[model samples]
Target: MSDTPDTPPDGFEFVVTGSGVELAVKRSGEGPAVLLIGGLGMPSVTWDISGLPGSLVDAGFEVITYNARGVSPSSAPDAPYSVADLADDAAALLDHFEVGPTIVIGYSMGCYTAQSLLRSRRELVQALVLFAGLQPSPISAMVGEMELGLIDRYGEVPREVLVFEQLLTTLHHPLLQDPATVTGWQQVLSAGYDSLWTAPEGFRGQLTASQQWITSGEPTPEHLAAIDVPTLVLAFEHDLFFPPDLCAATARQIAGAEFAQIDGVGHGGIFTGPGDSAARITEFCRARRGL
Candidate 1:
């Protein structure tokens, strides 16, 4: 592990080599450990946009974030990888830090990796917070396939444009509907896309990994039912990608898991409108810790 001068305020960066991959990991803050796993095509730095990382830090949690394999600053192997592989990377990070137990937070595609970690490295995960998570379903699989096709045809730029458009048109969140907010978001997204994604091959690798996991036929209801850890499932009311009902259903499979919906927000709400997201997560983590 190494720390450089360029590390963000109060946070230090290090490289953890495990499972034939070198992951770029960042750690910050104090108190209970909170491990954040981001969604598809998102690097750890993307979390800065959501403000959730800072909020979590202020809430007295040591926030841990990382760039998964295939993302820049992390070694990308040529071979295809699985969700379990990603979980191994997370476990490796926790081991490197010698953190006893952490609250694992997963967003969108990260939920799969989180679940894998919970199943395989239960000792490392004290609780779970799944944001906009869903079990693999036919509709969701179809959507993934459609996205893969778009990536193949138009590449990442058009795909990013399509996703931005979808967030605006389908979510109907005020943050996205406001003209000024929309323009600001467009500028931010455009300016950061290349930096965050780094390489088209890396993005394609992530897409391939997601597709493989979705089709892997694991993490079924039976599998989820086996998870006894405390879990908080937060779904957005207007998330077209993972409908609230589906998210709720997934929560029900986990024994004694708490399910909630953030009203008037969509899949991108956690980043655009983080008020409810931050509040719900902080409350859940505190409650789990019996604070």
Candidate 2:
């Protein structure tokens, strides 16, 4: 799976994840359940684009991927959904599918949700993988200042474009250059925009909630300590958002957790592109689980 778009398997479905939001979900393979919690604004289809969930499925684990609330298809409720609420949605997804003791893989925002999930639903996750992850960053204040500056410059130009363009600039690690990676991300944002445009009010509400969540520097040290499951934290050396030292500190906080820094790759490369990232993740999981 070279991050090239492939023919999607036919098992994709939709179900209501808490807050009455209908979430798009895809499941495949037939072994232990491996839940893939994606970053903010991820559509189920993006998993296919990135070749992540598919590779994990090919590796003999039952893979589950879904859009988080306020993304695509998922209910962007009128009110804000707290981090715990997001984690509960994950637990509900697993419970609805009768999948337990799941191996939870959290990427980016998914990493934050996964940490929250560990505290909220400990029994559901048997193992944890934090890839290109971050704890609540101190830079939230800086980000808020930037957002304000943007607002001052470009007054009220629909949040959809604001967010989409902002993501285009900040989310992808390389920033600009790789045509394929950028195109793939565009496709994802297009899908998300289409989904959001269907209910603009919902989209607006979700966006506001998300901004609040991003700026809220909630302390989660206790939750980090409460993570008793076997954990692997893969820190990307070039990730601008999540510094390696911070990730190492996060790994250190979790008793007996393993942390490794994948050199020369940026944040997006941790999951997308033809990097050695997936192999490293697969190897770690197999060795730790003795497969």
Candidate 3:
């Protein structure tokens, strides 16, 4: 809700990447590592804003969170990077910090990257907290549905303004909250939208890349099922993006994975608001680690 990204309770800082990108990395508390990977179009600082990382820190886990590539402080390399590449970045971050057997907490697009980590580097990830992450099959159709819904809602408008408004509307869903909180979230999202629009060409490029990937449907349940680590799939009951049905389906596909539906929340609710979902996440990780 604050205009600026929330400050860390324990004061964390940047960690430089091999490619000269100084990814913002924050750490608090001390114990087995629990890495928090954020959703799309948000800085690493959002975790602080939501008080998620700090809560985990307070609970005595070595919590690590960071901005993903091409988002703010993280380097936006010219070369094309897929979800797999983003997963590699996660591994690189762990390697840089000399941490392993991590419990990964991924939300939204970060969920895709988290699965990539499990698929690519299974040994590095001990457990997973998949918040609003589901298999990619249903996701493609969902996007189309949103575009159509926007068309119906807005009737028609200039492509540019429509895209902008659509961006704003799409950014918040599944979690209806207090008007004040909604306003605050709008401010943060607006700031992010400004950043997203600043590099129009780059933004479009990324969008196109994402669209191609989503439509390709190459990353299916079969691909995700390759991951053999312990996983907890957290779904919000009213999430418009990744609904509880999809999350449960994802969990069912994974062998021995646990699934829990978070009530009275939306897609992004786990990270923000009262943070009841975040507490559940910490408990899940702690139970898995026997901490």
Candidate 4:
């Protein structure tokens, strides 16, 4: 592994996945591997800044993270992609490292990939910590459809407009009510808006994947029942995209899976205070895997 100004500080190596997507995989600490799959357009560097990896490392576990196909340091598809396609990338990354059955932590979009990985490549996932996954979000699905339609009808929206919309959708309602906090979020989103502008098709591909997931009726009852491995469905209280009810249903679908909620936060709760989320996740790992 080597470090470059453009990549994560902990260093990363490019792994060629089955789809020929080069994932900039980053591994830290030394112990049982814990792979973290992030949301749409998120990169390894952003995950590092969230402090989740450092928390896990201190808790005595190796943390593996990577930028998805569309993100920089990773290959982007000229065409739109699917959730299963991203799952294939996850499976290939583990195989590339030859890391045996492992604990998986999935946030937002990562949760979808994690579920797909478990269904298609069960042997690779020992456990799942699903955050805002396994639920149907008609709102998001419709919004995703509209967003793509607009882009197709027109072209890429202005960066300023994208950043503004992201900030509004990402921050908690309470945070938005607070002038100071909302401004901080606006600045953050404005500066680090690579997810959308990085590579147009790649960004669109990620959006299309989410849209299809909602339209596809995935995680069917049979699919969830087939999952025999340990699973955790962690939900955020104020997540508009995947409300508590939606998240709870996902947990119920998975036999023997645990369901828990964090109060007073939205979809971006994980980022509002990284350590709190990390601590809860580590707690789950310790109880489930004893590591």
Best by TM-score: 4
In model 1, the Cα lDDT at residue 275 comes to 48
Among all windows of ten consecutive residues in candidate 4, which has the lowest summed lDDT?
1-10
TM agreement with the true structure for every prediction? 0.84, 0.77, 0.77, 0.91
If the candidates were sorted by their TM-score against the true structure, best first, what order would they fall in? 4, 1, 2, 3
- Candidate 4 per-residue lDDT, tens place, 48-113, comes to 766778888987888899888877767777657899999999999888888888899888888889
User: What lDDT does model 4 reach?
Assistant: 0.78
The Cα error of candidate 4 at residue 280, in Å, is 2.0
Residue range 69-144, candidate 3, lDDT tens digits: 6665444655345677677888888989888679998886778788778888887898888877564446445564
- Give residue 233's lDDT in candidate 2 (0 to 100): 85
**In candidate 3, which residue pairs get closer than 3 Å at backbone N, Cα or C atoms, i.e. clash?**
174-266
Decoy 2 TM-score against native: 0.77
lDDT of 2 at 56: 75
Which 10 consecutive positions of candidate 1 have the poorest summed lDDT? 1-10
TM-score of 3: 0.77
TM-score of candidate 1 versus the correct structure, residues matched by position: 0.84
Q: What is the lDDT of residue 280 in candidate 4?
A: 77
lDDT of 1 by residue, 139-203 (tens): 55776677678777876547465547544633456666588877776776667666555356666
